[model samples]
Target: MIRTVVVAGALLLGIGVVAAQQDALKSAQAIMKANGKSLGGVLGPMNKGEKPYDQAAVNEALNTLDDTAKKLPTMFPESIKGMKAEGDYSPSSKIWEDKAGFTASIATFAKTVTDAKASVKDLNTLKAAFPAIGKSCGGCHETFRVKNS
Candidate 1:
């Protein structure tokens, strides 16, 4: 009876770890998707506006982006380092092949937001900064991420 209880407890612990990782992964993806959508919406309206841009809104957006970048690394799949090389379980080869580039892309995005937080008080400054940040994100998507379609 004691041995059975011990085995059951171990199984539960293993499941708990996997479940926690999955929950974390899902939350991170949701955050990334929502943040991407928010950025797109801001850019679309800002580009077509003839009126002066809202500095407060731009700053708020930048703040959100900065937060996301800081949270990005923790979202990596828990099995990334231990997956079978020949199976469908390996981490993206691009990530391993160009680790420095991957890090740099995210770092650049974070820096853009940090700078934008300070420069967004002016419409012209924000106009310049916003496009630069968008380009960094686009660069990453072009090289590393695949589209769902």
Candidate 2:
């Protein structure tokens, strides 16, 4: 009976580690998504012609996005020392499930961000950048993120 209890405790601990990691990843993703939405809201007026594209405002938005992008790599759960595997609820498996496709999607995203950042000076150029930006996000969400859950 004591041995059985010990085994069960170990199993629970392992599962807890995995679950915690998943939670951390999910939290990071949520943070990024929230940041994106906030920036998008700020940029929308200029894009929609509701307000003139203010270079200062646009630059601010882009700077925020650049910061967000820089923080992205750290959020990924590549490794966590001392964390035990408890359970798993990540989209990592899906993200890498089709390795080639995933790589292409991420590459496209990076390129889109790079182009958008570089073209921040001109409203017309910024407008042009929107499609690529949206496409990059849509591609990842469709494949890696869970549907509406």
Candidate 3:
């Protein structure tokens, strides 16, 4: 009876750990998506001249992106996959297979965001630099993300 109880306790503990990891993964992904949306909110209006460009908001968004980029590599530890999160979005297995490449891509994106934050004094500068940022995001997604089916 003691052996059975111990086994059951171990199983429950394992399930709890898995659930916690999944929760962490979900939180991380949500933060990333929110940061992306925040950046988009800043960029879209400036791009279309729908509103006067807010340099402070742009800088804040870029900084958030940079911060997120720094955390990103560690966020997708190999164990994150196969965990059940409520969201359908997940990292591609290619991330683990080409960890170096994934890290490099994120590093490049972070650098671009830093540069943009430093140099974007006006709309024209943003226009010139934003596409590179967008490309960096696209490149990473193309190589390392799998959209929900």
Candidate 4:
């Protein structure tokens, strides 16, 4: 029957939409994880004095952070807004509830990175500069990211 065909078509369309949203979520999460690992891997050891400070590495990590900040706003689409946070890198639903706050966090992160790039010249400066960068990341994560339970 024509009605049966239409029903099946509607169901297929719904499934396709869900699948697309899942793909988008996974892609966004991967980008975040890579950025986090890249930055954290470099700065974390340096900050702890476990690894010698390397300006080139710091610069590269900051560049990654800069690019990630620009991509942050677009990663949260409407389709993924209400999805349950399942694991690491999952965005909180509060992101939609507080769009301006979320945006402000990104701006803060970008500015901190710019400052770090300008100031981090030596080990002492790297140590001095890292707290703000870490704070920016932690603050945003606290407000916008859903930690795994």
Candidate 5:
């Protein structure tokens, strides 16, 4: 009876840990999605030339992206790789398996955002810098993120 109780307790503890990891994953994914929305809101109109670019809006969006980039690497700790919760987008296992590579990609993205933020003084500069920043993001996503369809 004692052995059975101990086994049951261990199982419950494992489940709890998985649940916590799933929750963390969900939170991280949500942050990334929100950041993406912010980027899209600013960049979409700029790209389409639908309206005159607003420097203040570009700066604000880049700041948000930079902040999120800084947080991205730490968000996907090893424990949460395969775990999923409601609305969670699971990262590729490559993130944990090739952690060094993943970290480098994130560092590159952060640097790209920083450089873009620094160089974006006017609409023309922003238009020039945005594509490079986007490429950096796309490179990381191609490797570390799962494609949702």
Candidate 6:
């Protein structure tokens, strides 16, 4: 019957939408993971003197994060809009509510890293540069991310 075909088609469409959401979620997480590897894994240790600072490595990390900031917004589609952020760095539901603010936050991060790329010339400057980047990150997190719950 036509009704049966319509029902089946609707179900298939729903499933496809859900699959797309899952894929977007996975990609956003992977992008965050990569940024974390560069920021937390490498740069944090370098700042603490646990690892020797290399300017080339620092530049790479900054570049990577800047690139991420640009792409991160695309990961948050309308499909995922208003969805509660569950994980450590997942976006808050407010991301859709205040999309302009969310986007401004991303722009701030990109600007911070872009400025940092020029300022971080040596170990001492690297240390000096961290607080600004950290503030940029913390500001965004405070407004747009849900962590530890």
Candidate with best lDDT? 4
TM-score for candidate 4, please give it. Answer: 0.87
- Candidate 3 local lDDT, 1-149, one digit each (tens): 99999999999999998877887788778877867775577776786687788888887778778888888868877777655445666778888889899989989998888888888899999888888888887788889877776
TM-score of 2: 0.66
Candidate 2 lDDT for residue 89: 24
Please list the C-alpha lDDT of all candidates, in the order they appear: 0.67, 0.65, 0.80, 0.84, 0.81, 0.82
- What residue runs in model 1 are displaced by over 4 Å at the alpha carbon? 50-52, 80-93
Candidate 3 lDDT trough over 10 residues, lowest sum = 81-90
Candidate 6 residue runs with Cα over 4 Å from true position: 84-89
Candidate 2 achieves a global lDDT of 0.65
> For residues 1-149, could you state the per-residue lDDT of candidate 5 as single tens digits?
99999999999999999887877787787778867875677865786687578888887888888888878867887887665445434588999888889989988889989998889987788778878888888888888877543
Weakest 10 consecutive residues of candidate 6 by summed lDDT: 81-90
- Candidate 1 vs candidate 3: the TM-score winner is 3
Assess every candidate by TM-score.
0.75, 0.66, 0.89, 0.87, 0.84, 0.88
Q: Write the per-residue lDDT of candidate 1 for residues 1-149, one digit (tens) a residue.
A: 99999999999999998777666645755766666764776643674574446766666667778888897655565444332333122234465577788788888878877887776666667667778778877777677554432
Model 1 alpha-carbon miss at residue 32, Å:
0.8
> Worst ten-residue run, lDDT, model 5?
81-90
Of the pair 1 and 3, which is ahead by lDDT?
3
What TM value does model 1 have? 0.75
Tell me the tens digit of each residue's lDDT in model 2 across 56-116. Answer: 8777776666665555545555444223223232354554456667667666766767778
**lDDT (Cα, 0-100) at 146 in candidate 5:** 78
The count of residue-pair clashes in candidate 2 stands at 10
lDDT of 1 at 82: 32
Candidate 2 or 1, higher lDDT: 1
In terms of TM-score, the best-performing candidate is: 3
